[model samples]
Target: MATKYAMLARTSRLQSVASTEELEEATTELQNFTVAAGTLIKVASEQSAPTDDLQVFVYDPVLREPNTTRKYQCAQDSLLPVSDDLWPFIVSIPEPNRRLQLVQDSSRCNWLYTAMPGDVVSVPARYFDRDDFRLFECIICYIGPVPEIHPVGYFFGLELLDDVQSPQTADISFTRKYFECDADAAIFITADRILPTPLPQDEEIESANEAPESSWSLTNFIQNTVDSIRASLPL
Candidate 1:
């Protein structure tokens, strides 16, 4: 079975989410849940371009918010592999509140991950959210290939919350911590696209203080985070 982990973010805005109550009820009905996983995960933006934008596509299956959909629209020219030539390059605003907020409130959080295939080694996270889209306003750096940029993780399943009288449900997916690439900025990565991998091995992990020039991979990040979560669980 695939291992599980808990994602904890400090967000007053997220605390009031509508899915929390529904997820509790749905978990009870599920005899076994094959937590969200797959290859359709990746963040996109239309406000700027694939190279530059102010929105992130975070595909969490348990997500139910509907208001942030408009801001996270994908650009017409952007595509699956994220062609740098076809993508636009817009300048980012020097503001933290705007950038961080973009990540805090996104409807596409479920689409930001994928299953593990060893071919591609690294990716960068870009695209911003509508709430305060200033966090991701610079270059998107990847951890694997030298010039290629990608995202933090990949998501697989998705289910919209339904109005069931017996048990409520939480249509949510999965996610990971991302690093931004701006020298002048505080954040290192943004939610750009999901990598086609689940968890990473112990050797592939990287800490927050690690140097930027090293080769980075989503598997390493996922494995490290999952390990932390597993350790915290009660017996």
Candidate 2:
């Protein structure tokens, strides 16, 4: 009977994945679904036809390919509130193919993001000091959300362009590929641990000319991010 609700739709299990084909199959069971844990849904206050269930959409920036919406039905009791410091940051990422740097957040949270191929990035020595690695720069040659590594985030497949070597390939979780590079030169990282690398001066000038000034300045960026996350919620 509730009207508007904001919730994170999640699987009770460690993972729940279904092939789009399997999902389309009439006989596919409810246990076989693609709604992984931590997916976000906002109720628009509309009751679905016949079943009288509340209609909603399950979306995870980490799971959806190319970013699409999946409509779902659920009882009012099934929903839960959304609260997290990282989701707002995830929603604010700029376009794919931008340069980035990976870091290990002291907060113990790595990030989950939907990255496309051809993005350039780097990792600093400070991040991996405990490990033998010193430093490296890399380009994101491939990206995929499926074969979910963890419901927490999207992993990357990096092709290292620096002196640091790797022992992984372009794969994730082994069962699937997190952003993998080559077995000879690969390392996987989550979004929370990554930061964008700034573009060069010449390219920055060209980008400025290509687009009008945006409101992403120091003061405005925080304001805009807050506004965007607030507007996105159904609360």
Candidate 3:
């Protein structure tokens, strides 16, 4: 988020002159004191008004003057103050976000993420095959397939958060890193698998209500993932 700011001229400060009677007496030079250069300040808009003289809390901390805010007159010299553009505001412009766009499943069904990147969700099985693992929560760190790999995109690049380990670490090599994580913490997978698994707590509820069936032993997990990738492609 961009904060509103006012930039002061670096070379100058508030200029002062002697009294009106002294101004009538002196004809040549004006008396002044050296002051610090201008400061870029951030302030609460409610405390200030957009006028020629703007009141703001500048970094002008003084030894005796404890109160912080000060009012100063400013003009750009580019135009007349009455005709100048004042009180303008910045607005956010809309852009396309792929996560909001629909993704197709292995069976050509459409789906969307219930939890986005940086949020945890359970996948039926992760990238590699190891018998003891089943549904577990992994944070979705990315939303596209591995680069230069087949079926161009539509995979979740995950950062495995559980005690269970995997061979991947966002990439196979240093030059190909897709996301940052520990050396063996990442795995990329299709969106299809995230839908079928229940989170561990949800799994416990399922076990309490019904006979516990074997979640994917996934001896063929890699092959299954590959098949899903191919199935998602146009024939």
Candidate that would win on TM-score: 2
lDDT of 3 by residue, 152-216 (tens): 33456677778866555454443126677654666665544564333589789877877435555
RMSD of each: 26.0, 17.5, 22.0
Which segments of model 3 are wrong by more than 4 Å?
1-115, 169-171, 174-176, 196-235
Pull out the clashing pairs in model 3: none
Q: Order the numbered candidates by lDDT, best leading.
A: 2, 3, 1
Off by over 4 Å in 1: 7-107, 114-136, 143-182, 185-187, 190-235
lDDT of 2: 0.49
What would the per-residue lDDT of candidate 2 be over residues 1-235, giving only the tens digit for each residue? 4434234333432122345887798897654244434445556447656655565655445443222234455555555533354343332222211101111232323323434567677766455565645556777765443334444334556777776555343443352244443455766654544555568989999988674466356777788889999999998
User: How do all models score by TM-score?
Assistant: 0.15, 0.36, 0.32
Candidate 1 Cα RMSD after full superposition onto the native fold (Å): 26.0
Candidate 1, residues 20-135, lDDT tens digits: the string is 45567754332221212121113433335334332333334332112343223222222133222211110021222332332343432232332122222222222333453222
Each prediction's Cα lDDT score? 0.28, 0.49, 0.42
Clash counts for all predictions: 55, 23, 0
